[model samples]
Target: MTVLNGKGVLDGIAIGKIVFYQRKGQEAVKRHVENTEEELRRYQDAKEQEAADLKKLYEKALHEAGEKSAKIFEIHQMILEDIDFCDAITDTIKSERVNAEYAVKKACDTYIQTISAIDDPYLKERAADIRDISQKLIGILTNSESDTFTSEEPVIIAADDLTPSETVQLDKSKILAFITINGSVNSHTAILARSMNIPAVVAVGEELGLKYNGNNAIVDGASGRIYIAPDAETVRLFSERREAKKAEQEQLHSLKGKKSVTMDGKEINIYANIGRPEDVEAVLRNDAEGIGLFRSEFLYLGRETYPTEEEQFQAYRSVAENMQGKQVIIRTLDIGADKQADYFEMPKEANPAMGCRAIRICLTRQDIFKTQLRALYRASAFGNIAIMFPMIISVGEVRAIKQIIHAVQLELSGEGAAYNPETKLGIMVETPAAALISDELAKEVDFFSIGTNDLTQYTLAIDRQNPSLEHFYDAHHKAVLTLIRITAENAHKNGIFVGICGELGADLSLTETFLRMGIDELSVSAPCVLPLRKKVMETRMDR
Candidate 1:
């Protein structure tokens, strides 16, 4: 029996035979083509055929899945027809006098190398898309059949990683779960698996590839472990656990539409943290009261350039309108540290976590800040929209942000644009400095949402992302708890409300403590809303 550990992105249990999926290696031959024009024509013809095939896949996916899942094929089609991609192939053909297949491979490798070198995990995963499209084009040019997986029964798929296109083309009924040697929780494969309610474990390490194919495997997604040919006793234990989990899920689902009020009649708001407009659907499905933290940087990440003000407005407006009057707190760009945008032209700081990021970037680059402010104000007209600034540490930052909002409102008024003049403003109390002076800062904003993730890291003086420091990174440390207590007390004293919108907020063990601390709300991931709500309803606080 073999047990492998990995990071689980979704929760579930699956017992099935292992199915190893290997991408067929495509070798590009450097054969000289006398007719260069003929090679270009072949490239064009291959693109046309690939587009047609993708269109059919898109329609089929749309019928089986929703529009969001089907959008993967649409992105593939766009990539195949991208002018830069086409130019690279033609340029290679003209310069190297090679066959269409070789030129396409060369062009794809250049882009794949470039994208793979990026520091951001989300953008780095996009390299897989380039490779997937390149293989399709090569298959068409060489008259080779595209690879497909056909399973007689449901199986746990094991791969190095899966591209968005590859994931969409999967036979959902035959997929028990997915285990990948290389992938991030933010990868497209993980996102698709979550939407499909499938268990997935990624970054299982290269040692997992050594497991024999077709081995009877049990995947425990909740614990991020996989057992291969487990003992009879282990299997029985996991089977019972799985059944118990199913029961828990049913109970949680029944809690939907129920108010999150404690036994003592203390009301607590349960909200969701979303990164994109599409995530609002999950938020609604989880019956969250509102969106607590909308990471607006998602629109800026994985893109070639900054999103225009109009584009930002449309995205914000969509989330606002769909919420149907529920409050949506959108955090301005929190891009630096672990989340890096190449186009932002940010310098390579040794300690980016404490360096210029978040509100610092917006404050320095008012042009970019003003553009986002303009969009937020414009979208406020749609519904209850609130703006929140992240990584704030002082009264000066809050005042500057208010000034920018004031200027944006004036600009909108001058243009005769409709906007809500009463949009609420808030700030994230992450730093210890912010917590110490919460009373003074609370007077500047409407509410306070403690970002416990950064607060714990900052207070403990540990890098949360460093696995070596995992032992020292304690989210429930007394220092962190004291900071939260102080922040909440000050905010309440200043006639403002306080909530937690971090990973710590979803911790069931700390939920009672937060309630006792007078926390007004808990904003967690959509999946945690029902479970958190259940905890809230069962909680009691003594006066």
Candidate 2:
């Protein structure tokens, strides 16, 4: 028996042994590559093959998407041409590096290092799959048996780690909250779990002989507790806690559309951070005060070309119509590093995080920028809309964006597109430089929405995606808090408001901390709106 600590929502009676789950998608990709090699030769043999044209279109599409994606696409080409990853695996059979397992691990390490250096979380997740495939291939070559046991009865499966694919594949009705011995707060698996509203506990070091056979046990996902053989009394207490929590969730949901004011009569704005059209239903159901941080990346994925202006207009309109008269702060396309949609067909990049991404991509790709800006502008006439630019590093980018807005005004007028001229345009202060110059930037943009996620990452020189550096990526760091203070003071000095649209916005206990920093508004996920509002209603702002 051993003790461990973790955090997740508590659901009762799930007992099973640990099943380490990571990305196992490599075998499929490898199989595709193997099949495509022959297809490549066949295409080359054909006189009318248009590989060059396809490559050119891919290149063009990425160029329009953003700089980080363009760089990523470049690397993707390099991997296909330079890194004979397939050839390397084939040659491993001739001269074993050490043993079959060691060779597989070596291949995995090489591929992991290669992709882990990538900035995109979506692409980086594939690294583990590469290792998984290499392991599978080595086993096949060595004639080693793989885990083929299946369980008929529902059991609480434990794990060392989980990938997005694994979490999604799990039958949620059977599998309870996920527990991982190793995982980050920002991994795609974690994000998917949260998106599904499933209970999950990460970072539990494994040292227990949990039974594979079914046994009555309690799993506290919120508190990160796993009981192999819980006592009747302990199980009963957890049951009560679970019921109370569910009731509390219901109570919070009932507070939707009510108010987010505190006990001390301080009224704080609470809004939803939405991305998809389906989320509009969530916003309407929850009665969110407004839409804050409307991510436009989802539209950028899943196709060969950029989404048309009308398509963007429809998406933005859905959210705007749902909001009715409430204010909606739409953050312009925050693409590039973290959330690269597949439509971009971006090349793999070496240092995509530091490279041109998000608003920096918006700067060069002003044509695409105008399309979104035009859509947002067109939608503005339909509701209370404010524009936010992501990843601002200088006053020059703000001015340049203003010029684009001027250009958009001209185009809109020529095209007879209705829009709100007085709609507030804001900048997301996510860089240390931006925060340091917030006082100056406040004079330009209508307001400042401090994006604490990247702000903390940039300020601490910690890549939020890098688990090795996660120890330093804390939002509670004194340095990051000081920057938040500076940003708020500057915004207030300029008679402009400052809002926070990050995960930190939803942290109920940290409300007072942000209040002390003088943040004016709070933006969180749609479902989190009411709980956050209720927290605000009970919180005293005048600290």
Candidate 3:
């Protein structure tokens, strides 16, 4: 029996046969083609086929995964349609008199190497997207099947790493779990696995030999361990634990309609953080009271142009109407740092996290900000909707945002567009400066939603994205807790409600502390709502 340790990104248990997944290597043949015109024709045909395949994948992903995730396929489609990329391939084939496959391989390798050499980690990661699209095109040109998982029985897929496009194409029914030799906990693969409710363990060292392929394996995602050919006793124990987990999930589901009230009758609002309107279905399934953080930046991603006001309005309105009057807090564009869009043409910053991002971008680029505000206002008339600004640090920023809201409201009134005049306005208290002066900032906004993810990173002076610095990135540090306490106290004193809408809010261990801090609400991912509700119901502040 072999026991391999890894970092588990999702919590679940699965026992299945191992299916080693290795992407077919693209060997560039440098043979000269006699007919360059025919080679170009071949390349164009393969490109068209790749586009059609991506379109089908996009539609399928839209139905199965949601629009936000489906955008990955859209990004792939855009890559295929990139004029520069296509031109480069055509020029290489014509000028070099090379076969279509060889020309494409050279062009893709150049771009991939250039992107991988970038200093910014986010941009460097984009190389994977390029690789995925290149693989598809090359596979079509070579008349070979692209990388895929096909099995009649359930299996645990083992891979080096999965691109976002590859991850979405997986057949979930046949995939019992995923074990990757290398991956990040914050990668799209991990996020998608969690959303699909699939068990996944990543960063497991590559020493687990390929000889063990097709071996029986048990993946304990909660413990970040994979057991291969386990002893009979170990299998029995794991089977019992799996049963217990199933029962626990059933119990949590049974609490769907129950209010999140503590034993002392302290009612806490349990909300969900959503990336797009399609996530509202998960929010409803988990029985969240409302949406605390609607990451409104998703509409701007994976596109060459900014989304129109009408498009944004339709997206926001769908969530509001679907929620049926439940409070939907839509955060304005929080791009510029880890999240970016090429069309924005943002200037590179030495340190983007603290640079011109979030509220700064909105304040400086009021045109973009106003467009989103107009959409949110237009959607407010459909159902309950509130606007929340992100990365706010001072009272001045809050006032500036309100001024923009006022202008948007005036514009809507002039156009005779119906909107809720009483839509609630709020700001995310993420930085230490914001938390320290929460009392002053609280007076300007209707509510305070503490973004602990950034607050903790800023407080600890750690880049949470860096895996090497992860040990220094303590979310429950004394300073972070004190900041939360201070922000909660100040917000309550100013007669405003405060809530946590970060990863820390979903920590069941911290539930008691938050309840004692008088946090009015706790918002997390959809899957966490029921678990948090269960914790809230079991908590006793009096004790």
TM-score attained by model 2: 0.75
Error of 2 at 100 (Å): 18
Across residues 396-469, which tens digit of lDDT does each residue of candidate 1 receive? 99999888888888999999999999888999999999999998999999999999989999999998755445
Report the lDDT tens digits of candidate 2 across residue range 256-288.
657667787767788777766666776777777
Better of 2 and 3 by lDDT: 3
Against the hidden true structure, what lDDT does model 1 obtain?
0.87
lDDT value, residue 389 of candidate 1: 95
**How many backbone clashes does every candidate have?**
0, 14, 0
Q: How much lDDT does each candidate structure score?
A: 0.87, 0.67, 0.87
lDDT accuracy of residue 407 in candidate 3: 90
Better model by TM-score: candidate 1 vs candidate 3: 3
Give each prediction's root-mean-square deviation over alpha carbons.
Answer: 6.6, 7.7, 4.1
TM-score of each: 0.73, 0.75, 0.84
Model 1 stretches astray by more than 4 angstroms: 1-11, 28-147, 159-173, 179-197, 200-241
